[model samples]
Target: MWRVWLLLVTLLGAAGAQEGKVGPQKKPSPQNAPSGAPPGAKNPCESPVLDVTPKPPPTAVLDRESASNLARSMSRLLAHQQERSAQDRAGALAPSAAALAKKVIDENNGIHAVGVGLPQINLGLLHFRHHVVIFQNNNTAYLEHYWKALALSWNHTSGVWVPPFLECNPHSTEIWLHGFAIALTVEKQRAVAGIFRPLRLDQCDSMMAKLFGGPHRCDEETTKCVSEEGRGFRRAGYRCECRDGFYNPGAPPSWRGFPGEIVELDPNDVHRCTACPEQCNTCNSAGKCGVQRDPLVRGALLATQAACMLITVMMAAIVFKQRKCKTIASGMWTILETILLGTFLLYSTVVVRFFEPSVEQCLVEPWFRELGFVVCYGAIILKLYRHLIEFRTRKAHRWVVKDVDLLKYLLAMVVAVLCYLAAFTASSLNFIREQYKLVRTEETSSGQLFLACKPLWWDYVTEAGEMLILVFGIHLSYASRNAFTQFQERRFLCAAICVEAIVSGVFYVLRAFYVTTLHPDYMYLAYFVRSQLTSTVVILLIFTPKLWYQHKQVRSLAQEFSCRLPVDAFRAGEAGALTADGDVAELNLADMNPEDIRAELKRLYTQLEVLRNKTLRADNPHISKRRGGRKVAHRRFSLQKKGSREKVRRLVSLP
Candidate 1:
């Protein structure tokens, strides 16, 4: 093996030395000369073209030309047959087998066959191919001289020019593979199949063990890698520098490494490196790469968050103050306030996701969002239930009970929220994968990695939930359409729900096909947070102010009752009136709630009706003819006038 390698190297050296000498120049013919040149002048083409100011050797490739020239030269060194003749055996060796294999595999780095060849040379074949094979053939001298002549023409210094091909006999079986149909002997056949074949396989295994760190590895097979790793081959011009699947994540701008070393190829794992900026896919270490949100998209997301937060705080304050005004916190109406507050908070958080929505955020956001809607809509359903109950009782002329049964409603709301949460969880919301997109601008260039959620279909839960609420609210409104003024509270609730449903439904339909033009958060804000915007308006313009006014009316009614009949004088008036004396008695109406006040009004109306009937009977013509009747008529008129004046005072004092 040593002798064969030494002989090949010595031949290559002699060939290089001979090719370096300049050959005799050719004189140009008169007709072949340039039109402006003198006759018998040497053509400029006679001399080799040279660059006066040649650039330095490029550290990295800028184009395909240099690489292409290198490939062509390498191809010539490892001879590829374009056409095979009938004399050429199917499995045949080329001239200078040992030198050819060494030059093709070692110098070219395992790139053997190229350009749509019938058979691709496996890299593992390098192990067996490099073995020294001694052939007793007459064409041995011719093969050696042919290789020597071809090597002479190769340029070793500049390494940019194409190499010339060497011609060979087509019928030379003595120089081909061990087996041949014509002139090859059986001795050569036995040497190849018996001695060379097994030796080559063993050598191939050994080489694979050295190159891939394992004997079982095949050069054609790909390897596994992590999230930041990859594997590739050299058939595509990658010489273990940065393989095809690998990328350079440049160092941070603060790195003090060599100027061009900000990002360098990994020595171990081809794809593993650290150069990308925080929250970025790839960068030049000088700056981060992030996708900039469009101005309109950014503004909308921020505005929605700010607005929702403000509204949430305002609603909570109003609800708190309303409760402070002697209003029951554990009542059906309080549920609506709770719903408004929950929705506001949910919306505010939803808008924040537009900024940097990660996998964790996407996974958990829907749960809170669905829970908020459930609470709000569930409260509406309970309110409708309470309203219907009251409406039925009042129509039947039965005493209407105003008990809120707050615990029952709250339990029901919790159950509904849990059900929504369960449904959302069952839907299996998740972040599928991250997409690294390159961002380029006049100011900077970078790459951004965006995490998009999977199964975007679950967002319809909100729409379905809201639609159900609206349906029930509309039903309740219809049920109470002809309700008396005493049940006017239903009207405000009906109007509020209608407005909320319409606004939300319109936005929901719009968002069905509306894609974010700049950032994903824009769609998130429009879809998730916009519903709360409608809820806020309903609370501000409809719910809160109306409830505040009702509270004020109740306070005014209580104040007027206290002023008319003081607690200190109530006992004296009651005792005197019962003794049948001519003194008018003020009623004992101390500490009366709104419900008690309504009862008092009903009693007053009954008394006024009785008094009005007696006065009408006393004014009849038959009664006036009798002297006693005329006296009765005067007495009744006096009582009627007093009752009318009392009724007028009470009516004037009502809220």
Candidate 2:
């Protein structure tokens, strides 16, 4: 059985070798396989060996499809990369263009670009790029030549080449950039070596011919050369000095060829110049320049000064002439003088300084002017008090009284004080409280506040008070015109009372209504004008010669009346006329002789003695011997025939 099995295994191994080469299920021979091997290739337990064909390599069509899919993926990646590259290029260019624009703006300071048409050049390329290709087109030549001509012209006129820098261009950026680069190069060359020695006119003409491809022909009459009109290209004019207020547009051309060949031109010389008007100039010469100064302005100033001087001198003269006229009215005049002087000084300062008043300054100026009003009015108040006292006491002759209307005077004084206080309060309240808050919050200063808070109201009040005082004083003056005599005194008193009533009514209306018509402070000019007018009225009323003459006539009449009575009695030869007049008249005993006066006095004494005795008897009626006393008288006569008749009459009446 072993021989048979060995023989079978040998045959099966031979078969497996054949199957391994030709079938898919074949396994490697025992020599090729490692470790454990099947015990026998022809084992009955093993499945039967099957012959299977080997798989073929993939076809060319499948290979072609795979290659196509891979190629499509690669194409998508390349397209994405190209898009990213384009975006990057645009981003980089945008910033570069902006930077170039900013650089041009900075170079030109703040001048705005009116037109632009150019791509910005990258300045950084010069550093990294190994080589640069400078393209020279016809545009470059045109720009270079034009700029050169302008530079030459500028140099000829101003004695310095006005270097051109980057400016807005309507063409392409490349053209402008190239043009500016050339200009910058020329400027740099000038800075290093100074400009090529100024070229003579002939040399400049030759250079222009070469650049413009034509010879330049200058017009002898017009002084302009052949060039395009209405464009920047223009020929240089003859070298000339510019007139006042004018300047040459360019440098002067250098002298060359013929000596003194260059002509001089005046830049400001008018084309058909006419002389300034004679009124404007002092010069009478036909061709001479006239003075431009305004004579009217000077005349106005001079006139103002003259007027001020006249007023001042007149005031001084008045003051000097009326020094002794210290009447209440005269005091007002003095106050007026002071006011005029102060105002003159203030106005003079303003005129000299040419100050223009703002609202605040206006207000303050009035306040300053009002100081005079207060002082003048205060003096008038005092004067009024004196007049009032003189009238009341019948002491009109006493021009100066030690004591006057104390109460009214005190009230006036109080009002004056209140006026000042109110002024101070108003000014302070307006400025410190109202304006100060506004100023502080707004961070402003006091320049205007000082002006706005001017004491106009204070001045108005002062003027009003002064007016009142004047009226009262005038009334008192009228009333006291004949205080020394009863009849004239009564007349004056009545007249004064009437005047006072009228004045009071007028003043009341003015003070209560007119003054309240507007804010007193705001209407300073009006107030000043009104006050002056009122003063004028008062002065006219008080100083009228007619009124003064009438007063004098009344006084004279009173004096005549008082003297006439005594003179009449004396003329009639009436005795005791002097004595009856009063003690004052008796004190004047010089009119009578001592002896005649003594005799007259003695006779008068004897008569007085008799009259005194008769008066004593007349008091006793019982001594008359009436009928009612008859029985008593008979009894008394019988009983005492002796006892006494006188005693009997009295005794009988008693019984």
Candidate 3:
């Protein structure tokens, strides 16, 4: 029996040595064996705890009862032996596995170990699989399966928590290797071992369901998440690798990277990833591009449209009022008002153009904006010059014909300039439409059509021309500031021009920079603000005064016509009665003909002259006696003297 026992031990030892040559071997200590598993029974193929390989058929036959008894005895013996070996192997691996788990946990910052899921299991000849539950500092848990764990090492680069024993495919599915796993430095030698694969979407869903007690949708597969299944793994997880046009909207607002940069699937989150808006390729929680204009821009555009409409109405009223004032020839002023109205219309169009982008509107809006600005300013400058002429000549009629002829020339020149600019603009826009139709970035959802244009040199050229004219107008107004007939008018005109020029210049500069940095929506808002400000300032300066003056004139006319003549005053023959200081009080001339008015005024003047003569006679009666020494001489001299005095006053007051 002793000899047989010695031979069995020797054969078992030799078999273990032979198996060790295929891959690295781990010798489990008997003292450290687990309580349940027998000492050398952890890996049956490695140690041959029962040597259960089938013998060459059955040797001999016997009675049924005898054969059954023998089979039962052999089974008991094998079970007892296997149990002892498993205990031994468990004891041997326990300390090492514990140390290894600790080392891994320590290497991975400060994650806590939530106990081992399964003790290390040598699936094949040499390779072992370790199941460890790790809790991240954030309270999130991960079930990590370590393959070829005996030789595990921390990979400092790549930031992946890959075991050192695995030779990871960097360019392939992260930490994966193809072909049969050959013995590398005595590690696992299985057909496909030492490979790590993430859980598949379904597996992750199952795992998440198990953890949180609810069904969970897994993150979709992405390019960065590509990986092959190894022995028992699939590629999927909570790691953020969002699909194209799909973003993790639940990510932190401060996270400005591409959509899936740092997707968090904490318990608080509803969905890990979401699709961007139809018009967006990538977006934030608000479904807006990173550089997109805010909602305030739309509000501002609406406001601009409202202001343009209101100003348009006011301008139209002013023009109508000026037309009604037939006493004042408002031909040039009418042209100016018309130009302002056109400017407001252009502003309205520009505002709407941004609200909805159409190729046709884009083609014409730029021309409209530029031409309206030039012509509007040109008309205003012309009005200023015309006013200066009237002031210098001091005769409104002197420049009437000249102004009419000059206005026609001005209109013709404006038309010519507009035609030139329109041609240039058309050519440039056509080129843009033909040549640059597609967006440069493949990820951008905006169509190939150009939404906006950089100010070309020719664009600046036209702007510079406009600026030169505006500056010239400013210079002329400043130079003839004192020459203006009304200082108030000059002040308002200069102020409006200065405001428009400054505001427009600033807007241009800001828009140039904003267009380059921000999306077109923001630039649209800036344009709206600029257009409204320019039109408003112009209207306030030019049209407001005219509207106010017309209002006052209308009120005066209404008051004049509404006045009533008392019957007592009419009976006293005071049709145009003179007050205490020889001033004629207003009389109600309602329904009176021009002839009746002329006759009444003449009679009143005769009465006033007779009263004046009576007063003079009372004051200096001696002069009447001495003058010419005759009644005819005195009367003729007094009449001549009064006529000479009226002529002197008229000549002195001539400006």
Candidate 4:
């Protein structure tokens, strides 16, 4: 056995070695033959003369083909070289340059560089020759012009043109200082025009002065300048100009604040800010221009919205639970509510991300927006169905179709159908097709469509209809509550419905008016408070002791009233009772004793017996009437005796 195992192991080892040596199979190489050889020429391994070159073609043909091939090869080689050079250049720039490039690309696929240090007015020109070639087939001229002009003003670059500075020393203080001066000058110009622009002058000078005595002025004009009484650059006929924060000594006295300090443009003069022709605030805002906009702001807003939705959903759940609102039908309502909230959040986020009101403002197509409305409204309709079911049944715990107000429900259904039809009519088949086209063309993983479409009023209308359905349906539910419960239930339901309606209505109206009314910042808090109130109302209505106590009191009162009714009176004037000329005397309880009660009982028993006998006999109506007449005679006698005795007893008691 040992030998057998050893043999097997040895064989396995050998197999593994052979596998390793062989590695993976290699692909076969093409066979080579001498140029101009016959199609069936012998393989080079089989013939010694198989490698000979073919005779050259005629000079003219050879030259033409050679020249063409050479030109094509050179073109390809040069293209590759240029691509590598461009990549290398990009790699060599600071990481900020790449970010700036990406920003430019995002803006318009254009590129420019702004100086980073003091006096950072230097603008680095990007070679547009390559961009021109690359975007020749695309519309890129506008992009180039936009970036060039923006960079020129932003970087405070001198002259209308950008200069190539491949060997420019980025760390040079002189260049930075000059850039700073240019930036200051540009800021001063913008400030005069009422544009709230940031001052980019390096604070290093002041900071360093505090650390180390400020260095001598490096600029030629400022180097020789000293204190006003001292003989320096000013003594030699050189005028000294202070930095942005410092005032010129010889200038007419101005206020003691920083001479060139930039201030925010007042709203009154907002129109004068030339940078933003019609909207000065747009340019002056933090993310508007000359300031870094935090990407995290969008993310944070989205998170806040998500949190708000979560809270709202939780509140809704609490409300439903507290209301003791049960029913298999309500499950659908919960699901629809969840879907609505989720979709709302998703839609809002998408809008924030891709909806650039100024540039790509029209990308969200009308049909897509309409679809969003449909989804929201559909949720509302579902909620309405739940309310209708609950109300019509008059049962909170179980769903019954018969309980719903069929008329109102049918009306709602009709409205819903009409809304759906409207949505269908307004549907953008073309937009959907375009979305499909985008999917096929773009390499994106998100399956969302309508990224590039424009929003329309129809979308808002669909949403409005949906909200109305929900509001009305809730109202119906409140109305269906028992009259006793109506006050509180109606108030609560009305408040909730009103809130939803008002918010939704206002949102639509603002959207219609193109106003930014909804802010993500406030959504969470608003929804949270609303949800809490709704939950509280639901809880109070569902678990209030007053309702239960009232119900019990009502039942007790009914029983007491029923117990007090005269049982004998109900039996009076019947066929079994005394009937003299079809008139019956009233019973006197004063004379009635245990015997009388017994007698009355016996009479009733006897009458019941006679009726049973008659029934068994299958008597016709006349026969039955005769039998009943006999029983009536017996009851009359007994009642007369009882009444007389009762009168005697009453007289005795009175005396």
Best by TM-score: 3
The 10-residue segment of model 3 with minimum total lDDT is 135-144
> What is the C-alpha local distance difference test score of each model?
0.42, 0.34, 0.45, 0.34
TM-score of each: 0.39, 0.25, 0.42, 0.27
**Number of the candidate with higher TM-score, 2 or 3:** 3
Q: Quick one: RMSD of model 3? A: 29.0
Q: By the lDDT metric, which is better: model 3 or model 4?
A: 3
lDDT of 3 by residue, 1-655 (tens): 2232223323322212222222222334444333322232432122211111111112112112222232233223333334345346434443443444344334432221212211122211222233332211111100112322212221111112222111221112222111111111112111111222222222233322321223323344431232222322222323334566666655675643332212333545433456766765555554554334456867767775877777677767756665634222343456656567557755765555655444455556656766676567766676667667655543322232365655686678668877886787677667777884322211124422224443456657766776787788898687667663432566666777787778877876775555555455655666666766777767767666665655565555445534554434543346444455322343445555655655564465569978996786675644444433233323333346557988999999999
* Candidate rank order under TM-score: 3, 1, 4, 2
**Which tens-of-lDDT digit does each residue in 1-655 have in candidate 1?**
2233234534421211111122222333334544322122244223211222122223213212323333343344334432544124223333333334344335433222111000112110111232332322111222332333222322232222111111121222111111000011121121011100101112122321222222321122222211111221111111112222223345443533221111123233233333344554444434445454566866766686677678677766766675634233424346756667666755645564655555566557766666666666556556656667655633322224343574476667678777766766554532222342212122221234334554345578666866887887788878866654332556666776787778778876775544322345456656555655556555654455556666676667667867866776557645675546443244456555667776665466568978996886675654444432333323533346557888999999999
Ranked by TM-score, the better of candidates 1 and 4 is: 1
lDDT of 2 by residue, 1-655 (tens): 2233223323322211111122212333334332211223232112211122112113223322322332233223323333345335333433342333334334432222201111111111110011111111112211222223223332231222223222111122211111111111121111000111111122123333321223333333323232322222123312223233222233243311111123213333422212333433322213223223334654555465556546555755665565543222323445435434443443333233223234444444444434433433334445444545544562212233443333355446546655665575577557655554311101012111111222344556655655565566566556555444322323332343344335435654564443333332333333333333433333333334333544564456545544654534543335365555443333333464554544454465569878986775575653333432222324433345565888868987994
Pairwise TM-score winner, candidates 2 and 4: 4
**TM-score between model 2 and native:** 0.25
Candidate RMSDs in Å, in order, are 25.8, 40.0, 29.0, 30.2
Give candidate 2's root-mean-square deviation (CA, Å).
40.0
C-alpha lDDT of residue 180 in model 4: 12
- lDDT (Cα) of model 2: 0.34
| Model 4 agreement with the true structure over 1-655: per-residue lDDT tens digits | 2232223323321211111122222221124333322223343112212122222222323223322332233223333333344335323332333233333334432122222111111112222212211111111211222222223433343222222111111121111011111222322321000000111122123321211123223232212222222221111211223322222233343323221112112223211112222222222211122112235665565566556556556745654553322221223434434434434443453334433232222333333443434444344444445455544543323343332343355446546655665555435445565562222211112211112224445556667665766566566655555432322433444444455556656655654543223332233334333333433233333324334543454456444533653446435555345455332345544455655654554465569978997686574432334432222324533346547988888899994
